[model samples]
Target: MSQNYPQLDQATRDELVRAYIAIQQIYEEKGSIPKDSETILKRYQGLLETLGAIHLGLLVASFSIVLNFFIVNYILHLLP
Candidate 1:
């Protein structure tokens, strides 16, 4: 029974079963497992997220330098 499969979620049992059958069919047709399963997609997604974070950090640092330069120049201009 499907209830015996622990990995099956409460709602996705049918979908997972269909995908599993498709994977089997693909293996029969091409003799190899598909590498683009869910886990691989998550890993690539996380890598993209980390690269985005690095870019954001660089932008923030560049803006901070420009802001500090303007503040320092304005203060020096007001000195007697």
Candidate 2:
């Protein structure tokens, strides 16, 4: 089966690329992942999750607005 992937914006994609480079550099220099790098990655993950939530919220709000417009128009038409 084909899998669908979420499309990431350029800035987020660039951030991930930078993170990958940092991890690779740390591994090359120290032969293991450091605590600081792990923490930074975690923070990035949290930021991405928060952004996803905001997008979802905006989508829901826009849909509600469109629905409300139709509902109000229907009610108004029924009055006269």
Candidate 3:
């Protein structure tokens, strides 16, 4: 059986690629250095925060788009 997944737009795909590259670079750097759990944890935390912010921003943007659509339609219906 085959499963189909929704496609991401170019901008979203680029953002995901950038995030993946950043994570890979961090791992590469860590491998070359003496193990420092604190630093690695901090780096992961920072990345998680940044990704969380991006997710929040996208959520707000989507909500605003939907709200605007409803608001505009409501206004249009109000016009004689």
lDDT scores of the candidates, listed in order: 0.83, 0.81, 0.80
Best-fitting candidate, scored by TM-score = 1
Candidate 1: pairs in clash: none
Q: Which candidate is the best by lDDT?
A: 1
My TM-score estimates for the predictions, one after another, are: 0.50, 0.49, 0.47
Q: Which tens-of-lDDT digit does each residue in 1-80 have in candidate 3?
A: 01232476667777888998788778878795444545766778979899999999999999999999999999999999
For model 1, what is the error of residue 67's alpha carbon versus the real structure, in angstroms, after optimal superposition? 0.6
Judging by TM-score, tell me the better candidate of 2 and 3.
Answer: 2
lDDT of 1 by residue, 1-80 (tens): 46588776767887777898998888867857654465665768978899999999999999999999999999999998
Better of 1 and 2 by lDDT: 1
Off by over 4 Å in 3: 1-43
What's the C-alpha lDDT at position 50 in model 1? 90
How does model 1 fare in lDDT?
Answer: 0.83
Clashing pairs in 3: none
Which digits, one per residue and each the tens of the lDDT, describe model 2 over residues 1-80?
Answer: 01233577667777888999988888867867664546765769978899999999999999999999999999999996
